[model samples]
Target: MNSGKSLKEFQEKLTTSRRIVALVGAGLSVSSGLPTFRGSQGLWKNFNMIDLATPDAFYIDPGLVWQFYSWRRYNALQARPNKGHVALAKLSELDGIEYITISQNVDGLQRRAGHNKDNLYEIHGSIFELRCTSFMCNFVAKDNFKHPLTPALQGTEQEYDVKSRKRSLHEEDASISPQFKPIKELSEEELPQCPVCKDGSLLRPGVVWFGEPLPLGPIDQVDNFIEDEDVDLVLVIGTSGTVYPANSYVDRIRAKGGSVAVFNTDIDQEILDGKVSKTWGFKGDAAVLLPLTLKPLIGEL
Candidate 1:
């Protein structure tokens, strides 16, 4: 209802909950100066995400796909973890609390923010990880964070500003474009390759593609954690709450008698008004709200 009362309840939940899970999304990283995939300035002009982010896209033109991902990796590499990430990390450090962050984002900021490896799950996989596309080859490891692959271009790194794209979205030429297109049509050898595979299958981004099944191990671990522990609270952060499996956790936790709290830019008043029974909603910038709400629990205020 009132701001004072809502904050008091949030602090109470933070202080008393033993098993708290944070369902994180792209909005959590917005303050880190990264652009989300769904908005107006998202994709490079004339390059549909559907045409560039799938296995079919990679198979048809690996060079194009790698170029797009290279640009993404370069941007993600440039962004440092923001206050929201720091706040979530602090939640895990509470003396007796067990906090798990199941992030739908692949940007790797949560891990970069110093969240514990044991408590964090990047359900969509990370951009820094490269895996062989061959169904048979089992080569997958952390990439060296390489940018502007030598074979793809023969000059200093090209400059591409996301701000420019945002500006373009408002201008007469509303199509967002980046300067990181492949310099020339690259052949098979020019793309990233699996060193272990004899047939030279290319390595693809380790993200979960449009139709790909989520990695089994992490999903199983999340399910096991919820089933084994008596979870009391779930903090839904920045997600649109649309994707399957990860999105289903909210209802799953509620079925198990856990309460839900949401932090987002646009929170529905109905959810906060007891329509969902034990749910609370906090609306605003997560980078600003999270630290203010969570830091006091650690006596850091």
Candidate 2:
């Protein structure tokens, strides 16, 4: 609404732009059958994402942390790539357009949707990935075959869409503290070990938790991409931008005098209008909106 430009006008602007980038978030995945926080039916109903997703919380109870992520992964696996993801991938083939993507989502749907790995940067890490925890272990992004949370994590898959509708679009707050049930008690003998170090402390899911720093390699890659590229278009789809590094990517790109286009249902108009000037904010179900709006920009999707 800021520019009041029609979708065609926006598309023309993008077509003529030399450099383009997109920063996608959880909302982009919702259409693919994933969930976002704050919906009335969100997965965090009895719990808060922050408390269960931080290093301090994991240290307090790794079992609980693992259970939460395990549940997340299970549901993520059930979802397929949606139109939004497919559209972004199509942009990769457009000529004269230097496009790059940075995603906060840990789910691997973007890649699964057919986006080029060379152009994508998964900053938060992926649930399909595991890593070694020992200080001396060099193991990174290892594939995890183990399923630790079976019973408690099973029911979530059935209610994925139901929960998404319950998520309140306006409940997100950067300052909110996440609180979840205590982790199930497990014997020290039951914990997984580090494979690379052979110390039995091998951690699972090499993601950047709530209080942890993002992967330095990918972080630096994103930094270099933004700094070196004279970007013209940035599409921020489905993220509340609540977290720091993930949230900051949009502002950083904007500071360089680039245009932004936003797609999400949860964020309020007041909040969005204040944050971006050249941004185009689309409200309502993103999954349904994406195919209709971006089909022209990205063909055959």
- CA error at residue 143 for candidate 2, angstroms: 5.4
On residues 199-224, what C-alpha lDDT tens digit does candidate 1 reach at each position? 99888889988888999999999998
The residue ranges of model 1 lying beyond 4 angstroms of the native Cα positions read 153-183, 272-275
Report the number of clashing residue pairs per model. Answer: 0, 16
C-alpha lDDT values of all predictions: 0.79, 0.70
Tens digit per residue, CA lDDT, model 2, 1-301 = 3343556656776777788888888888877887764456444536677677777877777765666777777777778988788888887766667888888888888888898888888888888787766667767653453454334443432323322244355666433454443445654345555555654774656788766777898889888877897678777778876667766777777788887767777666764455546666667666666666666567555
TM-score for candidate 2, please give it: 0.77
Candidate 1 differs from the real structure by a C-alpha RMSD in angstroms, to one decimal, of: 4.5
Of candidate 2, the 10-residue stretch with the lowest lDDT total is 156-165
